[model samples]
Target: MHAIKIRLSQEELEQLENLAGAGYSLEQIAMYLDVPKNDFIAEFYDLDSFVNYHYKRGLLMVDAAAGLALAANAAGGNITAHQQLEKIRMAQFVEREKKRIIYGQETP
Candidate 1:
Protein backbone atom coordinates (compact mmCIF):
# COMPACT_ATOMS: atom_id res chain seq x y z
CA MET A 1 0.00 0.00 0.00
CA HIS A 2 1.23 3.48 -0.83
CA ALA A 3 1.57 5.66 2.25
CA ILE A 4 -0.17 9.00 2.17
CA LYS A 5 2.10 11.89 3.08
CA ILE A 6 0.78 14.22 5.72
CA ARG A 7 2.15 17.66 6.35
CA LEU A 8 2.29 18.64 9.97
CA SER A 9 0.83 21.94 11.02
CA GLN A 10 2.67 24.30 13.37
CA GLU A 11 0.81 22.96 16.38
CA GLU A 12 1.56 19.39 15.40
CA LEU A 13 5.20 20.27 14.98
CA GLU A 14 5.26 21.61 18.51
CA GLN A 15 3.57 18.47 19.78
CA LEU A 16 6.04 16.31 17.94
CA GLU A 17 8.94 18.13 19.53
CA ASN A 18 7.49 17.84 23.01
CA LEU A 19 6.64 14.18 22.57
CA ALA A 20 10.11 13.40 21.31
CA GLY A 21 11.64 15.31 24.21
CA ALA A 22 9.60 13.21 26.60
CA GLY A 23 11.26 10.09 25.13
CA TYR A 24 8.32 8.81 23.15
CA SER A 25 9.28 6.21 20.55
CA LEU A 26 8.49 6.91 16.91
CA GLU A 27 5.63 4.42 16.93
CA GLN A 28 4.20 5.98 20.05
CA ILE A 29 4.54 9.44 18.61
CA ALA A 30 2.70 8.30 15.52
CA MET A 31 -0.12 6.91 17.59
CA TYR A 32 -0.34 10.01 19.72
CA LEU A 33 -0.50 12.16 16.61
CA ASP A 34 -3.37 10.04 15.30
CA VAL A 35 -1.37 9.17 12.23
CA PRO A 36 -0.82 5.70 10.87
CA LYS A 37 2.66 4.43 11.60
CA ASN A 38 3.55 3.84 7.97
CA ASP A 39 2.36 7.28 6.96
CA PHE A 40 4.27 8.91 9.78
CA ILE A 41 7.38 7.01 8.77
CA ALA A 42 6.89 8.04 5.19
CA GLU A 43 6.63 11.68 6.17
CA PHE A 44 9.71 11.55 8.33
CA TYR A 45 11.80 9.07 6.38
CA ASP A 46 14.46 11.57 5.40
CA LEU A 47 16.88 12.05 8.24
CA ASP A 48 17.89 15.46 6.91
CA SER A 49 14.35 16.70 6.55
CA PHE A 50 12.58 19.16 8.87
CA VAL A 51 10.71 16.34 10.62
CA ASN A 52 13.92 14.61 11.63
CA TYR A 53 15.56 17.91 12.44
CA HIS A 54 12.81 18.74 14.93
CA TYR A 55 12.96 15.23 16.35
CA LYS A 56 16.67 15.44 16.98
CA ARG A 57 16.35 18.94 18.36
CA GLY A 58 13.81 17.62 20.81
CA LEU A 59 16.18 14.88 21.95
CA LEU A 60 18.96 17.37 22.39
CA MET A 61 16.68 19.57 24.46
CA VAL A 62 16.07 16.79 26.96
CA ASP A 63 19.73 15.83 27.03
CA ALA A 64 20.68 19.41 27.77
CA ALA A 65 18.10 19.67 30.55
CA ALA A 66 19.31 16.43 32.14
CA GLY A 67 22.92 17.53 31.88
CA LEU A 68 22.08 20.81 33.54
CA ALA A 69 20.36 19.05 36.39
CA LEU A 70 23.27 16.68 36.78
CA ALA A 71 25.71 19.57 36.87
CA ALA A 72 23.67 21.32 39.52
CA ASN A 73 23.48 18.19 41.65
CA ALA A 74 27.16 17.48 41.22
CA ALA A 75 27.93 21.03 42.30
CA GLY A 76 25.88 20.39 45.40
CA GLY A 77 28.10 17.36 46.18
CA ASN A 78 26.01 14.54 44.80
CA ILE A 79 28.57 11.80 44.21
CA THR A 80 26.38 9.76 41.90
CA ALA A 81 25.55 12.73 39.73
CA HIS A 82 29.20 13.67 39.58
CA GLN A 83 30.18 10.21 38.45
CA GLN A 84 27.44 10.05 35.85
CA LEU A 85 28.36 13.48 34.56
CA GLU A 86 31.98 12.46 34.25
CA LYS A 87 30.97 9.32 32.41
CA ILE A 88 28.89 11.35 30.01
CA ARG A 89 31.79 13.69 29.37
CA MET A 90 34.16 10.82 28.74
CA ALA A 91 31.73 9.16 26.38
CA GLN A 92 31.22 12.39 24.48
CA PHE A 93 34.98 12.83 24.18
CA VAL A 94 35.39 9.30 22.91
CA GLU A 95 32.64 9.82 20.38
CA ARG A 96 34.25 13.02 19.17
CA GLU A 97 37.58 11.28 18.78
CA LYS A 98 35.97 8.49 16.82
CA LYS A 99 34.25 10.97 14.56
CA ARG A 100 37.48 12.84 14.03
CA ILE A 101 39.21 9.65 13.03
CA ILE A 102 36.48 8.64 10.64
CA TYR A 103 35.50 11.97 9.12
CA GLY A 104 38.58 14.15 9.55
CA GLN A 105 39.14 16.80 12.25
CA GLU A 106 36.44 19.25 11.27
CA THR A 107 33.52 17.22 12.56
CA PRO A 108 31.19 19.10 14.90
Candidate 2:
Protein backbone atom coordinates (compact mmCIF):
# COMPACT_ATOMS: atom_id res chain seq x y z
CA MET A 1 0.00 0.00 0.00
CA HIS A 2 1.20 3.49 -0.79
CA ALA A 3 1.84 5.69 2.20
CA ILE A 4 -0.29 8.81 2.57
CA LYS A 5 1.74 11.99 2.87
CA ILE A 6 0.55 14.36 5.60
CA ARG A 7 3.16 17.03 5.92
CA LEU A 8 2.85 20.20 7.98
CA SER A 9 3.55 23.46 6.14
CA GLN A 10 5.23 26.57 7.44
CA GLU A 11 1.93 28.41 7.79
CA GLU A 12 0.25 25.39 9.34
CA LEU A 13 3.13 25.02 11.76
CA GLU A 14 2.84 28.66 12.71
CA GLN A 15 -0.88 28.26 13.27
CA LEU A 16 -0.27 25.17 15.36
CA GLU A 17 2.26 27.06 17.44
CA ASN A 18 -0.21 29.83 17.97
CA LEU A 19 -2.93 27.40 18.93
CA ALA A 20 -0.65 25.63 21.37
CA GLY A 21 0.39 28.89 22.94
CA ALA A 22 -3.26 29.74 23.29
CA GLY A 23 -3.79 26.39 25.09
CA TYR A 24 -5.72 24.63 22.37
CA SER A 25 -6.13 20.91 22.28
CA LEU A 26 -4.21 18.64 19.92
CA GLU A 27 -7.49 17.50 18.43
CA GLN A 28 -8.35 21.08 17.63
CA ILE A 29 -5.04 21.75 15.93
CA ALA A 30 -5.14 18.50 14.06
CA MET A 31 -8.68 19.12 12.95
CA TYR A 32 -7.86 22.64 11.77
CA LEU A 33 -4.91 21.23 9.84
CA ASP A 34 -7.19 18.67 8.17
CA VAL A 35 -5.67 15.74 9.96
CA PRO A 36 -8.49 13.43 10.88
CA LYS A 37 -8.55 11.07 13.82
CA ASN A 38 -9.99 7.62 13.17
CA ASP A 39 -9.64 3.99 13.97
CA PHE A 40 -6.90 3.69 11.36
CA ILE A 41 -5.04 6.78 12.55
CA ALA A 42 -1.90 5.39 14.13
CA GLU A 43 -0.23 8.65 15.07
CA PHE A 44 -3.35 9.91 16.80
CA TYR A 45 -3.57 6.88 19.07
CA ASP A 46 0.13 6.95 19.93
CA LEU A 47 0.55 9.81 22.37
CA ASP A 48 4.33 9.39 22.44
CA SER A 49 4.47 10.19 18.75
CA PHE A 50 2.90 13.61 19.32
CA VAL A 51 5.09 14.21 22.36
CA ASN A 52 8.28 13.27 20.55
CA TYR A 53 7.29 15.23 17.47
CA HIS A 54 6.72 18.41 19.46
CA TYR A 55 9.74 17.81 21.68
CA LYS A 56 12.12 17.31 18.77
CA ARG A 57 10.62 20.32 17.08
CA GLY A 58 11.61 22.39 20.17
CA LEU A 59 8.20 22.87 21.80
CA LEU A 60 9.14 22.75 25.45
CA MET A 61 6.81 21.07 28.00
CA VAL A 62 4.50 19.80 25.28
CA ASP A 63 5.99 16.32 25.29
CA ALA A 64 5.69 15.87 29.04
CA ALA A 65 2.20 17.33 28.98
CA ALA A 66 1.17 14.91 26.27
CA GLY A 67 2.70 12.01 28.15
CA LEU A 68 0.87 12.91 31.31
CA ALA A 69 -2.33 13.35 29.37
CA LEU A 70 -2.01 9.90 27.82
CA ALA A 71 -1.18 8.33 31.17
CA ALA A 72 -4.25 9.93 32.69
CA ASN A 73 -6.51 8.67 29.92
CA ALA A 74 -5.12 5.16 30.26
CA ALA A 75 -6.32 5.18 33.84
CA GLY A 76 -9.93 5.93 32.81
CA GLY A 77 -10.37 9.72 32.89
CA ASN A 78 -10.73 12.58 30.52
CA ILE A 79 -7.62 12.98 28.44
CA THR A 80 -5.75 16.28 28.90
CA ALA A 81 -7.83 17.19 31.93
CA HIS A 82 -4.71 17.72 34.08
CA GLN A 83 -5.55 14.85 36.43
CA GLN A 84 -2.97 12.46 37.94
CA LEU A 85 -5.16 9.36 37.54
CA GLU A 86 -2.32 7.34 36.03
CA LYS A 87 -0.02 8.07 38.97
CA ILE A 88 -2.82 7.22 41.34
CA ARG A 89 -3.48 3.96 39.55
CA MET A 90 0.19 3.02 39.71
CA ALA A 91 0.38 3.89 43.39
CA GLN A 92 -2.70 1.85 44.21
CA PHE A 93 -1.56 -1.12 42.17
CA VAL A 94 1.86 -1.06 43.77
CA GLU A 95 0.42 -0.88 47.23
CA ARG A 96 -1.78 -3.88 46.55
CA GLU A 97 0.86 -6.05 44.86
CA LYS A 98 4.14 -5.01 46.42
CA LYS A 99 3.42 -6.15 49.95
CA ARG A 100 1.97 -9.50 49.04
CA ILE A 101 4.74 -11.61 50.56
CA ILE A 102 4.09 -14.82 48.68
CA TYR A 103 1.39 -13.82 46.24
CA GLY A 104 2.95 -10.94 44.44
CA GLN A 105 1.30 -10.71 41.03
CA GLU A 106 3.79 -11.23 38.22
CA THR A 107 3.96 -8.07 36.18
CA PRO A 108 3.74 -9.12 32.62
Estimate, for each residue in 31-84, the C-alpha lDDT of model 1 and write its tens digit. Answer: 998988877876677765666777888888899999999999999999999999
Model 2 CA deviation exceeding 4 Å by range: 1-5, 38-108
The top-ranked prediction according to TM-score is: 1
**TM-score per candidate, chains pooled:** 0.77, 0.35
- Candidate 2, residue 67: Cα displacement in angstroms equals 22
Give the range where candidate 2 is weakest over 10 consecutive residues by summed lDDT.
51-60
Best by lDDT: 1
Each candidate: how many clashes?
0, 0
Displacement of residue 55 (Cα, Å) in model 1 is 1.2
